[model samples]
Target: MRCHIFTRDDWGKTLDVQETECGSPEEALQLGSAGVANQPTEVWCGPRRLGRFEPERSHGRPLPRLHALLTLAERRLHEREQHISKQETLINRLKREGRDLALALCVLDTLIETQKTHLHERDLIVAEVAKRFG
Candidate 1:
């Protein structure tokens, strides 16, 4: 059987893709596991996924620190999203009352930028989790 191994970096970016011949799916899985020294890897046969391997440090153990950080990031991202929603609602209400929107719009813009930062932080954490716990 022909197998393809995909090696990914800590950020889930594909660093390399290699093709190898294996006798079976087990051989493909072994090949993938052997090559996963410090990165995450995936083995595939045609359109079927054979197996996935992670670094030894995270082979079967969960990193409490990383999990906590991911939870915090997700919570912060959700809070920011809620804040943006409320800001938009407030802006709409003020507009309906024929009040000045210049300051409100500026605040909304700042909130949006902050939300983007939160989203980026959450994405980074998610990628890290994927790399460690694939």
Candidate 2:
């Protein structure tokens, strides 16, 4: 391997290389990398340009889509139901507004689910037994 070392001052003018080697560039770097001076080497920003460095970015937190949508829907429905119920109650006291009140109640009833009752003789017996045991 052979390496040739060349240095320049602020103006990028060619500087002197101490040793000569018949090796590759890697070997040349190793050979010339002796007790190197602790001085900051000057850069030739006039002729050659140095690329800008970019740092790693920190990622932000993610939100759940389904949970967000469900929360939004619940809030909207809750608001709508409150408004309609107020209107229905207002119309209830005044018979002239019965038609509008009924409509509002209908809408509210549709929005609210009815209670479901499902029971069998065997399930009732089991419940009764559990109640007696308690």
Highest-lDDT candidate: 1
**Ten contiguous residues minimizing lDDT sum, candidate 2:** 52-61
RMSD of each: 9.9, 28.1
lDDT of 1 by residue, 61-94 (tens): 3576567657777887788888889999999999
Instruction: Tell me the spans in candidate 1 whose CA falls farther than 4 Å from its real position.
Output: 1-62
- Against the unseen true structure, what C-alpha lDDT does each candidate score? 0.84, 0.40
Off by over 4 Å in 2: 1-63, 96-134
lDDT of 2 by residue, 1-134 (tens): 32334443222344453435434444444444441342112222224322211222233112242234335445555666676577566557655644445666665565453211112322443454455455
C-alpha lDDT of candidate 2 relative to the true structure = 0.40
Worst 10 residues of 1 by lDDT: 57-66
